[model samples]
Target chain A: MAYSATVGSVRHVFPDLKTVLARASPMRSGDVLAGVAAGSEQERVAAQLALADVALRDFLAADFVPYEDDEVTRLIIDTHDAEAFAPVSHMTVGELRDWLLSYDADGTAIAALSPGLTPEMAAAVSKLMRNRDLIQVARRIRVMTAFRSTLGGEGVMSTRLQPNHPTDDPRGVVASIIDGLMYGCGDAVIGINPATDSPVATIALLQMIDEIRETYEIPTQSCVLSHVTTSITCMERGAPMDLVFQSIAGTQAANAGFGITLDLLAQAQEAALSLKRGTVGDDVMYFETGQGAALSAGAHFGMDLQTVETRAYAVARAFKPLLVNTVVGFLGPEYLYDGKQIHRAGLEDHFCGKLLGLPMGCDVCYTNHAEADQDDMDTLLTSLGAAGCTFFITVPGSDDVMLGYQSASYHDALYVREVLGTRPAPEFEAWMQRMGMVGVDGRVRELPVAQHPVGALAELREHAA
Target chain B: MSGAADDAGAGAGASAPASAASTEPTEPGLRVVDPWLELRRFTPARIGLGRAGDALATKDQLALRLAHAQARDAVHAALDVDAIRGALDGHEVLHVRSAAPDRATYLQRPDLGRVLAEGEAARLRSAAVPVEAKGGPAVGATSGFDLAFVLADGLSPVAVQEHAASVLRATVSALPGWSVAPVVVATQARVALGDPIGEAIGARFVVVLVGERPGLSAADSLGLYLTYEPRTGRRDSERNCISNVRPPVGLSYEAAGHKLATLLREGLRLGLTGVGLKDEGPSLGA
Candidate 1:
């Protein structure tokens, strides 16, 4: 194919947005001609980069669409390393363009520039470039590919196994976890919402999950989604606590359900830290939130949903949460109302959360009353996975017996792992391999479902029969 | 760009961004050729509508404004008792209202939406309907019926005006051997209002079909709530809610009615309605 045809084939998908894309396309620059004409590939690439800088003047003059409160751009600009990035600072736009072109195949070098020049600064400079420049430069900026930065670490997809029990009974809990982990879940964490609100019940439930992890020698985290006070009480009482769990809204008032304030959140963090339970790392807060929470809690102050949702991230960042999920469809239908809105809200929330620097997760779920079905959640989950979502909640039959709604299933997690090349967190991945659930080929095994009524239920069934 | 391109290309339609935070090209008034225009001709969902400067074109904006007005009007619109009565072929009917006297009050104070009018509760209290031996009633035994329904002009009266009677009349025949209470046609009422009316009528099972909040795509949508034994202060989990009742796009009235009938029949059989019961059992194809 001709060069124009090759690019045009990609452009044909969004033919209407051509003009908008053209502004971003490096093809609009003839400076690549220098590369095309040069004697060596290296020199040609250099010439192309030089021309990209020459085209920067046009980008500086081009009219652009305005963003409302672009925090990403601000971060890049705010953290520019003038001394370390003197190479970038002193170079002309043309020279800088060539320099960035050189790293098109190298992610580590691209990541290295973040501290030296800042991601926000690199992003700001890239903003002025054409589409070709944007795509070329954008492809290289992968961060923390080797280091496990608290989240399932970089370069892998993960899920938190949420095996909720109606009574938080060991039987129900054990059955669901066996099913989920066998299908290769719990890479992110194995969290559960306690059926009973009592601290004793909640603590027992936490211990139960912890015991299972120990029994199987599973390298995963456990959480009980009762109030933070319950987790804190358990921590203080020497219970096996992995992640401190809470439901946070955008504002203090919205957090009333969790009985949370920044101070209380801080106190909970201190308490959880005192427990010293996180074996992997100290980052152990798990917060679940949704869009209309602030507005429903009467703390929106008329701010837009997406804008207000980002503020919740500030709270997440404060605790340095291990996982932050926006339960987009769990809120009432009045807020999201339908499949399309739910899908849009999930993406917007993910984008905003990821931009605000959090390992964002989504409960791609809906209720019986909602106009949405599993299909909508699938679309959102697939999109989020491609966009680098860290985790999601899994259910046994895709239904939360106690919470009374439906979410992603164990089937969904296996499907994500199969399709997206995502896996449970790295440490957990090794455990799955050791257990022979994960193949040497890196595919999760389709293990047969465990017979339910195990643990307490098994004894009851045995006695009754 | 044609209106069709807007819908099909929403996510796929980003161009190379400008130097600033601008996502759109600097060019103004120049139209770009749209590839998804043909695909866009398929759905009426706000796709592919061309843009004017920064906002929607005049025609699109006006249509949107019109839809907004229509939805608002549906919320504030009053119930037509005569039209409703004309549509129904029921056992009996009683017209009452919620405590919120007007639409404005109902919008502002949701607490009032849950209760019946001052004398309305008394009417239910006073009206004694005979019942079968279906484990008696949970609340008002002598006053309530075996099963009751409250048709409320919830968020959108337009939905009730259009769908309620047709749906109820169709579903009634499917419900066999049960002594259903007189249908309560309520004004400015919410789901919980059915509980008090059911309590007054001494109903064992209650279902409320009310107008759902309108979405940008569908305005005249309806919602239904089914409770095994409903009463005041009952939590939402105690009831099984079925929503998005409309036509051509949403859950059709017939399907909604069938689902309601199935839940009620099952609830009566199992002596339950809400949490712990799954709708997965014995699908009535509702």
Candidate 2:
């Protein structure tokens, strides 16, 4: 089917839904790299105008990627809730945007309508939104999920204390962990991205964090972000496992490039559930997705990068994941270009994920080669916080030496909480208050490590003893 | 230096302020340094940085910004071709450029960096020095040479400028009997740029020593990629990489050369250079 929009003397036509979606997407280098981006700024606005009139129901009628060819397409088609979609079936993408911002689409209303919305519909409506519209709509929806600690609640934000080390040294990892905990971070999870993907190294890192969590009685989970198969092997070896982590993408082929499948993820989830590790709930998966993964893997199949990224949320929501975040700028300038593009993509991912009833977080980060700085990250961090983002990835001093990029520091979390009046996950906050690391007013106590009430590093020495 | 040297003494013992009696009125921007700041010795990660108020201390913040600035500069830094030529004084070095016209285009369009400029391949094919084959009639050889060595500026020209010549010298000396082609010094090049250069030289294997993307911590880290059969459009899985060749902070020049030599010996023996060829030939000690 052809879609057209006229501006002044020019009439632009999009050949298909995928073309319209690609043309309407906010300017990003990845789409341009794929040669699917609109030819000019006027054409982009026209595509957005054309996209707004497409009915939400049309997204269901045809798949952007054929179902027989793509398993991700198959998952979207098979899992769609016709009953839930009946309420908004008649609305166009433009009308849906209006309804989303209206008084009628409250937290409960959006939650009820979530099952009815597919990733494509969510992606479609997001194209018609400005950054503020994305923020305002996402702010209203709360996708609360739990493993040991609950995430995605009103007036609460969580952080993934990513204490990554260059060589996965236990001492270096523990030092950062101690530093992050003192700053009142790690409410979501103390997840580590091991520099090496070997199973033995992964198990050692897992055991180290587990010992710390057990010794200190911190109310949170720990994960070593290795490949899913390595996590599975660690689980089989009786290692202390919490959330199973994997980097997922939108297309089946892209997932294959990551050496994963739906069946493999299910098996990993089943293994984690069998461990019976969580005290609060059984949402035990941690997923990381980004915009350029599919395109980088040569698996985008002609869709825009953002639309493909939204499809990843469909995969995440299927498993009731405890945490799912878009590593927004980690892919670097080739995809998101610079700070402004990274900031916009972060909000779009959060809005789309939250709108689809999945707990969404963002790695408000950038690589050195990208045209960005801490100031840009500050903008995104503040923006995502205002949008009630589920969590942020907090590294030590905002520099991840192992991953070789910059992310929000543990102190950045404190800044956002103070600015937005958001606290850590409830269980983690209570633990910190009990330990005197934070006060009841949700302020992290600024004290030297030795003088602080929680002498976490000293405790690590004693544990070694 | 106490905690920096002694791993076990890294906590508060070495990190506390010099004297308790020296306490004075705090200045407006004064930061309460983490008593265990000495632990910074253990990793390059920015840790134990004292916070002023749930934020990085001014010095620490500026240090991070400085590191970032340096890394960005490393990406845009031009390679000093004469310096590299001076380093490898005895070797026959041929200069070439990739299809990318400038640094900005090279950074954004990676595809442009993988191919040579319009006449570069043709020029190399006609002008390359002829060499005798070492192992008679190798499985993948299109030309007489067994291996082609390429040095590319890649994302971190700092890496190429700092370590490429020394590493290349060490690697060449280690491969005693192998028929090696004249080294190609490529500007604005990616790892895959070695393919057409190698194919033009008719070598069985291509080793591209290029500058890796500059990380905030290590700006001059070099990477070595080896591809067999020497052709365009080779999948990444069909290549083996030995990365982080910057010294002291990363792999030393000698160690990277040793690893490359091992991979070369095994790759030629196995007649492959990718997933099929693992780097288990021998340790540097062996």
lDDT of each: 0.58, 0.84
Which number leads on TM-score?
2
Give per-residue CA lDDT, model 2, range B1-286, as digits (tens).
0001100001110111111212223467765544464455555666666677767777777777787787889888999888888888998788999998998777667778889999999899876755633434443344568788899998888888999999988887887767777888999898889889988887888899888777775778888999888898787778998887878867898988888988888887678888998877654332
Worst 10 residues of 1 chain B by lDDT: B1-10
Q: How far off is residue B132 in model 2, in Å? A: 6.5
Give the TM-score of each candidate.
0.52, 0.92
On residues A285-366, what C-alpha lDDT tens digit does candidate 1 reach at each position?
7788776676555565333344446557756756778888888876544455567767766765665455445667888876
Error of 1 at A426 (Å): 1.1
- Please give the TM-score of chain B in predicted model 2: 0.82
Residues A1-465, model 2: lDDT tens digits = 889999999999999898999999999988988999999999999999999999888898766888888888899999999998998999999999999999999999999999899998999899999999999999999988888899987899999999987778787788788888888899999999997897899998888898888888888999999999999999999999999999998999999989999999999999999999999999999999999888888899999989999999999888889999999988877788889999999999999999999899999988767788899999999999999999999998888877777899988988998888999999998898888877665588876666776555655733432
